[model samples]
Target: MIKHIVKDTFILQRLSSVATENDSDIVKDLIDTLEANKEICAGMAANMIGINKRIIAFQDNGKITVMLNPEIIRMSDAYKTKEGCLSLEGQRETTRYRSIKVKYQDTNMKVKIKTYKDFTAQVIQHEIDHCNGILI
Candidate 1:
């Protein structure tokens, strides 16, 4: 089911907890919500849907990818940019990386490490920040 976008900064600002296999339903809801808002949004954190879990779904290449407990292990080539959120009123300026290395769990709770660059990396960084209770 597509969930409502959370706009409450108080909620979005709270740190997200680690996700477990039981949170699989949240992964589905995240994907469904992201797809529903694909025209205007690229990604979303679990907090964005009123669930403060470490899960994120984003448009990568031509498909949507889900990550649970995503952490940026390494980041490089930082630059400033503005971003818009489906739960925010307008775009905000913030720093982003051109490349990033992340550690996260898949829906099945298997750990995976991956490198991302350019826009994709930026998107991941933004969502991870949401998990950390950082808002731009």
Candidate 2:
């Protein structure tokens, strides 16, 4: 079982990418962490829990979705808003797309392409920023 989170800015500042090996364990950890934090947050990234991998789990409309190696393929219209992170204190101004097309892999390593708009897109962009070592 995983307890506590990495709160050091230096560690969270480092960038992350796709896991090259032993993804099953990483996926399990991600799922476990996300499930454990479901009531506290709407989304989380691997790095938020100190794992430097390109993975993010988010809850939308009572459903949890996990994405590995997610990338925004297309974006339309930018909006400035304030968002908070579980790994950091308080919220800040963030510029995010109103809508985005993302490509990512599922836990089974299946490729998926999907588009998100409004709040869902905001959540995804925030988590992707974590994968890229951005804190907002």
Candidate 3:
């Protein structure tokens, strides 16, 4: 099912249960929403489709990618970043890995791997944290 949780409510933003062979709809909904909303994410500098923690910024690269139930497979040394979450309303200090490699299922249920660093790392880590039930 596609569960769109309320932002800043915090409780609803948590690690999701692993998708079985059945959850194709949830994945599809997220992908459709994300792909359709790329322009708005760029315009606002942030996009929150489900929860603020799932919010991502569109890079100038002209693609909006959505990872369903993404998991971080690797992480680098810790670094501090001033973070902004749509749920939190403002920036806060959060220490997190400086780089990460994530594996997520695409809309078609094909697993995809992507590495992230710098600001991209920040956003990915934030989103991953949401998958783990942490709201910052």
Candidate 4:
């Protein structure tokens, strides 16, 4: 679907829903779009591309990974960091965990749990905030 990014703050503030197996195509599209725009987009939420589902696609070390219905189950102490979004202009100081334990479904809808740290952790946190309708 490689849709355009949504910049409407009112729209971005609305929460997204959990994605299901039926949304595999949507997830793929998001991954493609994210990778295509990796220069400007570190990661993206489905809502950012006009799909109102709880999904995110990100690039990690040149590989793209998708997370459906992602939630941060555990988080370390918060630290202030600068972050920007595809839906917003300019970077701002945001508080985020240096490490996080997340539970999310893969493209196949299989639940997976993983811990992320450092920059990856920060990127995941930023995208998760988008899934939750929280702007940075």
Q: Which candidate is the best by TM-score?
A: 1
Which regions in candidate 3 have their CA more than 4 angstroms from the true location?
A: 1-5, 8-10, 20-60
TM-score to native of every candidate shown: 0.98, 0.93, 0.67, 0.95
Q: Report clashes for each candidate as comma-separated counts.
A: 0, 0, 2, 0
lDDT of 1 at 92: 96
lDDT of 3 by residue, 83-117 (tens): 76544567789898878898877656688898887
The 10-residue segment of model 1 with minimum total lDDT is 82-91
Candidate 4 structure quality by residue, lDDT tens digits, 1-136: 5777899989998989878889988887898788778898778899898888999988888788899899999999799988888788998999999989999998878899999998888999999898888999
Q: Rate the local accuracy (lDDT) of all candidates.
A: 0.93, 0.86, 0.57, 0.88
Candidate 4 clashes between residue pairs 3 or more apart in a chain or in different chains: none
lDDT of 4 at 2: 72
Model 1 segments more than 4 A misplaced:
none
Best candidate, lDDT: 1
Question: What RMSD value applies to candidate 2?
Answer: 1.4
Q: Which residue pairs overlap in candidate 2's backbone?
A: none
Sort the candidates on lDDT, descending order: 1, 4, 2, 3
How much does each candidate deviate from the true structure in C-alpha RMSD? Answer: 0.6, 1.4, 5.0, 1.0
Candidate 2 lDDT over 19-71, as tens digits, reads 64467676677778878888878888889888899988898788889899999
Instruction: Output the TM-score of candidate 2.
Output: 0.93
How displaced is residue 123 in candidate 1, in Å?
A: 0.5
Q: 2-68 in candidate 1: lDDT tens per residue?
A: 9999999998999999899999888998999999999999999999999989999999998999999
